[model samples]
Target chain A: MNKGLLIVLSGPSGVGKGTVCSVLRKKMPDLVYSVSATTRSPRQGEIDGVNYFFKTREQFQEMMACDALLEHAEYVGNCYGTPRDFVERTLAGGQDVILEIEVQGALKVKEKFPEGVFIFLVPPSLDELKQRITGRGTETQDTINHRMTVAEEEMNLLSHYDYAVVNDEIEAACHRIESIITAEHCKASKYLAELGELPAAIEKA
Target chain B: MNKGLLIVLSGPSGVGKGTVCSVLRKKMPDLVYSVSATTRSPRQGEIDGVNYFFKTREQFQEMMACDALLEHAEYVGNCYGTPRDFVERTLAGGQDVILEIEVQGALKVKEKFPEGVFIFLVPPSLDELKQRITGRGTETQDTINHRMTVAEEEMNLLSHYDYAVVNDEIEAACHRIESIITAEHCKASKYLAELGELPAAIEKA
Candidate 1:
């Protein structure tokens, strides 16, 4: 059986990546969301292995040393990473996995798994992004401004993505992503590995 | 607007490329079917330009010399070729064009237009293919055997295609091709050329 796709949805903060992911999950119930393993203590209601694979500092480092994580990063005093074993197992089982992560983390994942389909979700425009960010009453002017700068930098890295979807509307973006997934499956490279093992024998027959 | 996609449908002679294309046309009414220019004398009710470009031998040679033909071949002392202008014009106008041709001609078209989306349609199996050819009921045993040999050779070239869709059922095959088209549009390379110019200026903003 063909392995499922590792679709990485990456974008800057407040670009609505989470909303898009949530919508996508509803649209595609079979899609598995990747759970990260982190050394950071879980907040209230966060479950180990579900919310995250709660790991000790030593355990996280060991995973890193063994190359057991697809991508890992240290934030503040805690380490966070996606477990490679779970992803590989799920994909091998022919179930697609959606990995929603920051732009930086997504690039790291690409280095480890170049075959992964990288999608960079962008807002329709800088002004729209600012508006969306500002719509959040919690953010102060400085925080919003800081995010705008970061978003611009992230947009510059758009060239690295397999597809750059404009998050103009949630449903539209999700539809486009679905089409992209369908197309990816149709791509020759997706099935060539399986076919590569058969052509010689089949031709002889 | 982004330029249109050049979708090339190819496969073995009896694999029902024409049937799939016909169904696809009804489904996607906007898809332009490429018309070949042929030097053969027009048969009854074969309208010029509508059915074929109806070129003379001298005109066909000029097209070949100028690289104006995407792919050209001679059979039974008559020449036939796909005009490069019609395909290019249709694509540049942001309208997708579908080229239904033999596996050999599709490969030739790829040599000229590397960006063309080459799809190979195949029967479910060799036995299925033989059954389909025999169902035509017009060929003698020798002709059927010869065609089977030729088809097997063509199937060997399957690796060259960007996508290989099984023609188990006409509707199912059409659906697969439609999904492939949707995915091709979502590909990053499709829009990167237009996006390339913007990142520099947008980054400065």
Candidate 2:
């Protein structure tokens, strides 16, 4: 069996990455979602190893010290990280893994796992992104302005990704993401082992 | 608007490239089929500039001298070449162009146009490819052996391609090809112009 792919998905704040990912999971049920490890206390309804692997700061620091985490960062006073063991086990069992992360975390994953397929999700347009952010209705103007500035910075990081999916419509974006995954499997590098066996196989035939 | 893509499709004979391409053209009507310029006389019902742009030996040589053809080769004592002008114009008009050529001609085209997306069509397996070749009925055992040897060589060239579409089922293969085209359009390199305008567009908004 072929080894599963390691996919890193990143986008700006209001690009609706979570919704796209949810629909994509429905389409590709076999996909493995990487649950993060965080030092922050779990809120109501959050389960250990389901929503997140809640850890104390010392435990999170221990994983980092041992080089057990794939990528990690401190955010809003909480330490969050992706565990390497679960990802490797899932891939070794021929199941693809997707890490939906912030741009900084995604870039850090890229540095550690260059072989992973990096995808950037974008809104249909900047105007659409602003509308989505505004549609949430819970944010103050100050928070909205800060998010727009951050979105601009993230959009500039498109060059770092291998593929981009524009979330004009949820279904269309999911389809593109699925296509990218299928196409990535068909890359020549993925078949090197089988291709190498061809000459001998032909001689026998 | 984004510029169109230059796509090269190649596979061993009997891999059903022509069939898949015909089906693809039906689905993607805007796709431009590249017509080769040939010194060989057009067979009955083959129209000039449609089947091929028939050219005299002198005209063909002039194109070669001027480097107007993207790739050319002498085959079965007839000169054949892809005209660069037609392809460029179609792409500039935002229409994707598909070039169906043999492996040798494809590698030659790659040298001149590395930006082109190269796709290899394949049978599900080597045994299946051999079966397809033998099923062609017109060839003797010796002729079949020669073709099989050549097929193996071409399959080894899979590394030269960006994507591989297995013709196990025509519709599935076509769908994959279509997906690849859509996904390719979303690549960052294809959207640099639009991306460059994002900051200003956001500032104005």
Cα TM-score per model? 0.85, 0.88
Query: For model 1, how does the per-residue alpha-carbon lDDT over A116-158 read when each residue is reduced to its tens digit?
Result: 9999897877878888989966667988888888888887788
Chain A TM-score for each of the predictions? 0.82, 0.86
Model 1 pairs whose backbones collide: none
Give the Å error, residue A193, model 2: 4.0
Q: For candidate 1, lDDT tens digit of each residue in B1-205?
A: 7789999998887999878998999999999999888898876767897667898899999999999988987743578789888899999999999998777788989998898899999787788888889998867899899888888888888789999887889998898899888777767666667566767656543
- Fraction of true contacts reproduced, model 1? 0.50
* TM-score winner: 2
Q: Please state the Cα-based DockQ of model 1 relative to the true two-chain complex.
A: 0.50
A45: Cα error in model 1, Å: 10
DockQ of each model vs. true complex? 0.50, 0.56
Docking category of candidate 1: medium
Q: What is the lDDT of residue A155 in candidate 2?
A: 90
Q: What residue pairs clash in candidate 2, if any at all? A: none
lDDT at A13, model 1: 70
